[model samples]
Target: MKNGHITQKIGFSALFGCMLITMFFLGAIIYFTVVRGIGAISWGFLTQVPRSGMTEGGVAPAIVGTLYLTAGSILFALPLGLACAIYLCEYSPRGFFVNIIRMSINNLAGVPSVVFGLFGLAVFVKFMKFGISILSGSLTLGILVLPIIISATQEALMAVPHSLREASLALGASKWETIRKIVLPSALPGILTGVILSIGRVAGETAPILFTAATFYSRRYPDSVFSEVMALPYHIYALMTEGTHPEKQTAIAYGCALILMVLVLGVSAIAVYIRQRQRIQNA
Candidate 1:
């Protein structure tokens, strides 16, 4: 018994140590980003366009472009992904083909972002003749995150109690009605979780947009979907790799990273808040 007790204690200590290490690394990243970037962040930095060959000025265009791309990706991906998930969970027959399709989606989710970028370049940029534009980039990102959304949504839908579905159908509601009125509502929180994750992924992705949309330096803001705009991730990369003035651009790059982090966190926090409130209401 003493030996068992000692073993349990050691196991607890190891798990606790791992948790501490994870937290330490996370905290270190946040701390360094803030410390290095905060100095460059200001009202002007947030609102003005870059100036003097991107050596000086703000990242307003990049911020706007990121927002545009993120929104476009969500809009493009959500409905289609949700529909596919619904069909899979509610209608797809349990068979070899269904399993194969599921496996394909899972594999697609694991595909490299760079490969998606190449695909976007070939399909959206070249074949479609959309050129290097926001539409092409947004579509590419939408496709990139589609697998994630579909997988999460499928899990969420499957998690809905079969009994609840039966009850809704038994109450004279049609299958579609049951799904729309009961199942979807019940699974919204989980769906939103997928959205939250997708937003983070979509916002941070540089590779997918590199060939399809991002331009190193664009003076004008994107006026339409066809416009090639500056994006934060690409902006930071350009600053670090291609800028003439190192110190200033480096500071600005850090600042851009900080802003991107904040944007993602802000959006995610809002999603989480909504999810929690939904749980409370449902409870």
Candidate 2:
């Protein structure tokens, strides 16, 4: 009995230590980002248009491009992802083909972002002739975020009680109808959370867009989906890599980092609010 208690205590201590380490790493990252970035953030930095070289510009175009990319990616990914999830959850039989698809999606999620970048460059930029444009980038990011969205949506759907599905069926609802009305409504909060999380991923991505969507310098905002645009991560990367003034570049990078953090935090807050509202409504 004493040995059992000692073993349990040791296990608990190990788990606590692991948790502490994880929190410490996270806190360090947040602290550094905030401390280095806050000084560089201003309305002028946020709103003014960017120019060539680190010393002369703000991230307005990059911000706009990030928004465009994020919006476009969400639009492209959401429908396809939700459809894939619905099909998997509602329509697909628990058979070889379904299993294969599930495995493929899971595998796709593990593929490196750089590989996705190369694929996007080849397919969208070269074969489709979209060039290194926002459209190409959006398509690439859409693909990247799809697996996440699909998995999350599938989990949400699965979480809906089987009884609810049975009730809908007993009401003479078709499978599609049940999914659209009962399953979807119940899973909407989770679905939105997935989307918000995907938005965070899309916002911070550098490699995939590096090959397809971003240019080193863009004096103007993208005029169309097919136009080359500036993006925040790419901007930060460029500044860090190519800028002549180290202080200016570091400052800009910090500022961009700050913006990225705020964007992610804001999206997370909204997702939480949405989930809370959904819980209340469901209750």
Candidate 3:
């Protein structure tokens, strides 16, 4: 027993050490980004359009585009993903067909981002003639995050106690009614957590958007879903890799990265607040 206790202590210490190291690296990234990017952030930077080959002016277009894309993707993915989770968790039997679907979802979640981009290009852009518009990009991103949301929501739904279902049925409630009134509310927090994670992933994706929706430089905000738009991730990539004015453009890239990070974090905070409130009310 003493030897086992000592071994457990060593294992825990190693795990904690690894966690700290991971956090330290993350902190370093944020610290460097802030140090380099703070000077470029201002009202003008946030609200003006890029000019002079993107060496002057602001990133307002990118900001608006990113918002549009993120919102569109969420709108497209949320309901579909939730419905899929519900079917898999509540309606489907544990058997061969369900197993195949679960396996496919897991595989899809592991597919590379660039592959989604290519698929989007082929299907949405060429076949559907979306032509590098926000709609195509959003649909691609929605597909990319669908598996994540479905997996998260399924886990959440499954976590609802089986006894709750049994008691509801015992009280003469139908399965669908019980799920709607009781299970859904109980599982909301976990579902929100999944949504938050999906938002983060969708917001940061460059590859999928690059071929489908993002432009290297766009002067105006997108007027419709069919319009091509500037996104922060693609904008940063362009500035760092394709711009002639490296000094000024690199600073702007850093600033864009900072803005993107803050945007994601802000969304995550709101989702977390909602989830916490849900848990409190449920409790």
Ranking by lDDT: 3, 1, 2
Write down the TM-score of every candidate.
0.92, 0.91, 0.90
Worst 10 residues of 2 by lDDT: 49-58
lDDT of 3 by residue, 1-283 (tens): 9999999999999999999999999999999888988989999999999999999999999999988898899999999999989999999958899999899999999999999999999999999998999999999999999999999999889889999999999999998999999899889889989998788888889999988999988898899999999999899999999978999999999999999989888888888888778678768
RMSD of candidates 1 onward, in order: 2.1, 2.3, 2.9
Clashing pairs in 3: none
TM-score of 3: 0.90
Candidate 1 structure, TM-score to reference? 0.92
Please tell me which model should have the higher TM-score, number 1 or number 3: 1
Candidate 1: give the clashing pairs: none
Winning model by TM-score: 1
Q: After superposition, how far is residue 47 of candidate 1 from its true place, in Å?
A: 1.1
Cα lDDT of model 1 by residue, 1-283, tens digit: 9999999999999999999999999999899889999999999999998899998889999999998998998999999999889988998848788899889888988999999999999999999999999999999999999999999899889878899999998999999999999999999888988889899889999999999999989778999999998999999899999978998899999999999889887778887887788678767
Stretch of 10 with least lDDT, candidate 3? 274-283
Which residue segments of model 3 deviate by more than 4 Å? Answer: 1-20, 271-283
